[model samples]
Target: MSRTVPYQPVLLRLLHSAIALLVFGSLITGFMVYDRYDKRFGTLNLPIIRDTQGIHGTIALAFLCLLPLFAIYCFHIGDRRLIQKESFKQLQEVGKPIWWISLQRFANSLLLVSATFAVITGRMMQEEWLPTGEFNHVWYIGHLIGWLLMFVSVAIHLLMSAKVGGLPLLLSIYNWKIRPEDMPKFWLRGFKLKPSTTFLFFFEAVVIGGIAIAFILPLIFTSPQ
Candidate 1:
């Protein structure tokens, strides 16, 4: 007997892939920044990129721009993939399929939370701080912790997803098949903002506004070198 492949929405694939790539970029450049400036833990002999901090900040800005849409979709349309109210209760059945499912959901939710944490902390930092040997800033420390949490969350997410859905589910998000109704043009027609999602939209707007301010503030209040 042949197994069937699972189908994923094209929108979800696009958002997930873009965010995943940005997250990986941020992680790499973040490490380079750390290796260059704050190697209190240990240092890598990685090739020095003079503007690694700028590169990381640019990637983080892109992430901030895209994350809200992804968050809205996840909370509204893809809620099933995240932790539910009963998720903790389901964890009691260890070694069972439900337990794996719940664990996957928990990891998925953690991924979102940690990503948001990293982005917020990253935005709070000054690009000049790391270069100027100011590594002890609270925001920088929070950003480092956020990076570690995101790394662990992503690992658990992949492992739990593999355990729950095996290869098919792991590959499903990358699948490009799209149903007619799921097309982008049809999205607006089907889109409806419920009372519950209203708050999500408001939150999304606030995050986007904050990102805009994060960009504009540097120009308005330039710190003297």
Candidate 2:
């Protein structure tokens, strides 16, 4: 008996891989910045990197830039992987395979929400605040909590995916073999924005607009002051 490996779309793999790398970089550099500045929880004995904050911000900005495209793809094309209208009802079927699948979908949705939370809060943060010993800002606290939630969400996401799809499913995202239909050249041909996803696309647009405003407002207020 052989385990079956499911095929993943090449665009999904590319977007997922890029986002994963950016998230991982942001997490490590975020910790380094935290350790360098505010260590109320406990400090690491690592050598200080003066530019960790800047590096973290750069990675975060990259994540922000990529998020809208990823969100659009996920909501429109990969919507099945996210929580559905029947998800909650399916949860009542505990111990059934559908229960696990529903749980995985919920976890997948949570990852998106938490990632957005972390990114928005991060965009609202000021680089100088932590270095200047201002550790209690509401945005900073929210950012810290957001990242913590995102870390937990990521773990839950992996566990749920493993539970639902097993190792083969886990490896599917990294599968490099692309079906002829999923080729980049044919993507536009198959891509149809369904009316059902209109609301989601609008919500994503609002979030992206909010992020842009968050990124721009500080500069506007602080300029030449």
Candidate 3:
């Protein structure tokens, strides 16, 4: 019999949702804020974001959309797609249905399409791919909306990732060459550990405290005195 692929874990699901919320929020808001190059936000003259604006937008949209469905597909198999046969060979035990594979590919396609639209539109708005637009009334507001959504999404994403195993998971991205002999009998069963009051601090530090600093710093620094 042919072996099948694996599904992502629960914690990862939370992270994906948070990232999606942010990306969609950012994209829609960005549509409002910087729709024109010579737009102004309050008294500050903000440059119309065009060329590279869509790069982050593209990534945000892709991650926002793809990560969840991928996570869902992984959920059925019981591990992250990051550790799949195509990516990480450590997890060859889990199995998946053919239909799930098709869905995953479709999700990936949506992500690519969203990115292309965001990038293309972003360029057009800035006149990189098209001529600059005359001063429109709506663009000034759109840019602010985009920035707000993006800001919220990233904060939530980071919080969810850190709350569970996002930080450690990030570290493990570079992990390599673990000996099969040295490997535990069931790593997926998870490592046993002591729980503590400190767990709440990850909440304080990431969701509340971390967001405050990451977001507020930019606003403070960027605003004209």
Candidate 4:
């Protein structure tokens, strides 16, 4: 008899992968922009690169599009996994197995907050400001702070995930040997807009609307310069 590894739901894996890629891309582009332009905080001596500010802006735009959808899925289907109401109470088990689960939840919650800050602050940044050496903007300061917070949150997330389930939980996000009856197609039914899903539908609509407004408001209000 072979041991079967526990598998994550395909929908969860898909969402996680998409979010991970976007987050990683944004982080890379953000660093490149920082190194290429801003060094007021710290300096990394590297070869000069041109046009990364534009690349960073492009990735940030994609992040704004995907993040709201990811947040919807997270709050709707994955909130319990990331953070339960009882998580704080698990602090009593600080030296025991339960503590690690709570830690992971807390880390995930922190990561979400950090990512939200990154997205919002990234949007607030005017594209023409950074490469032009205009780091005095409040939004740029907030963006830098968001970047640091995200870096710390991601480190905590990785360490907690490694401690909790070792490599199994980590690999579960990419596992493909799901049971025959557990096909991705079977998962589609859960997405149907029934009474149970009505609230999620409403939540997703609100998120999408908010993102659209955030993107459109500046264009509408900012007069031609």
Worst 10 residues of 2 by lDDT: 187-196
lDDT for 153 in candidate 2 is 91
Task: Quantify all predictions' global Cα lDDT against the true fold.
Answer: 0.77, 0.80, 0.39, 0.72
Candidate 2's clash total is 0
Q: How close to the true structure is residue 29 of candidate 4, measured as C-alpha lDDT?
A: 76
Clashing pairs in 4: none
Number of backbone-clashing residue pairs for each candidate, in the order shown: 0, 0, 15, 0
**Candidate 1: worst 10 consecutive residues by lDDT?**
188-197
Which sections of candidate 1 miss by over 4 Å? 1-3, 188-225
Ranking by lDDT: 2, 1, 4, 3
Q: Per-residue lDDT of 1-225 in model 4, one digit per residue for the tens?
A: 112355677777877888888778888778878877788778786576677777777877877787776766666656555666577789778778888888988898777777766776677677778667788887789889989998899889989987877877788888866676567676643443332344444544554555666577567646312
| Shift in Å, residue 101, candidate 4 | 0.4
Q: How much is the lDDT of residue 131 in candidate 1?
A: 73
Q: What is the Cα-based lDDT of residue 166 in candidate 4?
A: 82
- Regions more than 4 Å wrong, model 2: 1-3, 188-190, 195-225
Backbone collision tally, model 1:
0
TM-score, structure 4 vs. true: 0.82
TM-score: model 3 vs. ground truth? 0.29
TM-scores across all candidates?
0.83, 0.88, 0.29, 0.82
Best by lDDT: 2
